[model samples]
Target chain A: MDQSRRFTQVPGKYFLIMKIKLELFGASRDLSNKDFLELNLKNKSSIKDLREKIINYVDQKFKGNENLRKIIETSAFCSEDNNIISENYQIDKDQKIGIIPPIGGG
Target chain B: MLHTKIVDLSKEKIKPENAEEFIASSKFGASIVFYGTVRENNENKKVTGITYDSHDDLVIKSFKEIYNEADQKLNIKEKSVYIEHVKGYVGLGEISIIIAVACPHRSEAYDLSRYIIEEIKKRSPIWKKEHYENKESEWLKGNPIQAN
Candidate 1:
């Protein structure tokens, strides 16, 4: 709803761990019932890392819903700016990820 | 320069006929309108309704790209195309999308109409969700095409 929530800061042992916010859309929103999530990932984390966290978040929240897991795996990742990003892409500060699940428009 | 009647889901209903009316001209002899309707069932399951969402900005951009692509591929001179998609809830037998293409010849109109719809499905950022009577919902099985 807010499009994205502000990042949360976590105090880490060596340094303050910054949060990487993820925006949800379509199936990702329905399955997780969350519009945004703040991951304790450091800057420069791979897009694949973000993917894993989304998958894991679905797992934890939805339990044994394999259908939802598949959706996340097959979804296309995009930056907050709406540019498509590959799984190998890196996460950067101020960059918010959006999970666009398989589309079904007629 | 492109034409679209795209409107968010609301009390206002989508009229596929609008595509034809908007593109109608004395010079063009043929106009084809394609309407995509919401069906009552999917995979033998009774689907009560459907909904759609998209990255708003990219959806508009995608439409522009699609319009340009169609114009180039068709070598469209006097011909023109129109697209309209309704987001949010849509009931059975309602139009989800409307595509219209006008050309001097009927054959070209048909092909352009088909091509526009096909490309929109494959290339647009719009996504659909199906709701079954049994309280189950699935995001339909197609990836949102990413434009490079």
Candidate 2:
């Protein structure tokens, strides 16, 4: 299999136009504490598509961590307005999105 | 009247000189203050220092709720209350929490202060990290009973 074709199978690279800022917390600090990457999504990218992009990207970066992938899958994305947008939500251009882990503090 | 304020006593500088003035602002005849300090011993273990952390928004909201409940339950009118909890690190003998209540009488002030502290400990979302002499850290979920 070609590397480019395999890359598409990963989940983190699906977005083409909207920029996102991913923050790390707790055990996620091991992967990339300051791993904020910007991706420009193609116009009218749905939330489901963007989540696929994220999964692909993270899969490529981490390679063998199934646990991290599960965490990413279960995690929710918060828009700039603090709204929890599901993986299938539509993405708007230049929107600031945050991927947050489960908050466990009392 | 009921008044309450919760502050980050660790990072934010608290002026001790103004403490008396602030706690005695109302024309109350008596004011009681309770200071909770970090000690060197916990559960028979030598402690170095303690680190406290909390969700800023949630802690503040919880403190407000507790304060309101105290006011309503005690029917404390013409009284003022102050509460502060340390965030970050607190050394031995450093005050981690402070509660002051002023009322027209000493008994009421004492009772109110105790009630507020107990409720804050039971209800607040603040967590404490205890650093022991062996360089070990343990997270305490709720306030543990202390020996006077």
Candidate 3:
């Protein structure tokens, strides 16, 4: 059988690709009009790696301001389903990430 | 119901003209009021004036949450609570937040009033910018503390 046909024929043996969608808000929103970011990975990427990728993207976008970086480091990131994942949590490929800035001002 | 408003809390007008109405409407024997004012000094800087800013929606939401938490913990009726905060620039000696709580007794009112202020300071996202005498301004983070 062909590779694609054999994969399709196998009920649960085929590898499933995982994709993550990221959304940014607040000062992070100001970083880019590309409001939605997507990352495709195998099912094994840890949430910590996802966070590192996000931090790198943010760092590249906003080169200035150590304060902003520190603030982002401390800010919380949530799944689109509103699950609070620890930085080290493993992320499924099809999961969604929401980046939330630390809210300031009354 | 608790009443909350965002305004430029002013000391000159701190005594609301309708104070009599608010006092009269309360059946509680004790009504405690707390006025938080802007001081002339912050940290070691001479503050000429202070500008208060907030994400109004979030701030109000947080304030309401704090108010609700107080009500739940204290079991106080909705009618016995009132909280107001200043959102814009408030100069020296201006009132920033006014909290009034009425309870059947003096102790509850006093305790609740203090608790509300403390919680608001710790949780509210409101920030203050201190304008120094030397024409410098600094953003103050977290809660305000009494000058040493």
Write down the lDDT of every candidate, Cα atoms only: 0.75, 0.62, 0.63
Misplaced by over 4 Å in model 3 are A1-64, A76-106, B8-15, B18-20, B143-148
lDDT of 2 by residue, B42-90 (tens): 7999999977665444456666777677667877766777766656778
Q: In candidate 2, what are the lDDT values of residues A40-105, reduced to their tens digit?
A: 566577666766776787788889477666655655555666455665677766666655443332
* Candidate number with the higher lDDT (1 or 2): 1
- For model 3 chain A, give the 10-residue run with minimal summed lDDT: A1-10
| Winner by DockQ | 1
Which regions in candidate 2 have their CA more than 4 angstroms from the true location? A1-106, B1-12, B143-148
Tens digits of lDDT, candidate 3, B11-124: 334454343346445468888777788889867888888776654454566678877787688766643667777765777887777777777887777778887887776656
Across residues B27-80, which tens digit of lDDT does each residue of candidate 1 receive? Answer: 888988888989998889999889887766666767887777766887776677
**Candidate with best TM-score:** 1
lDDT of 1 at B93: 84
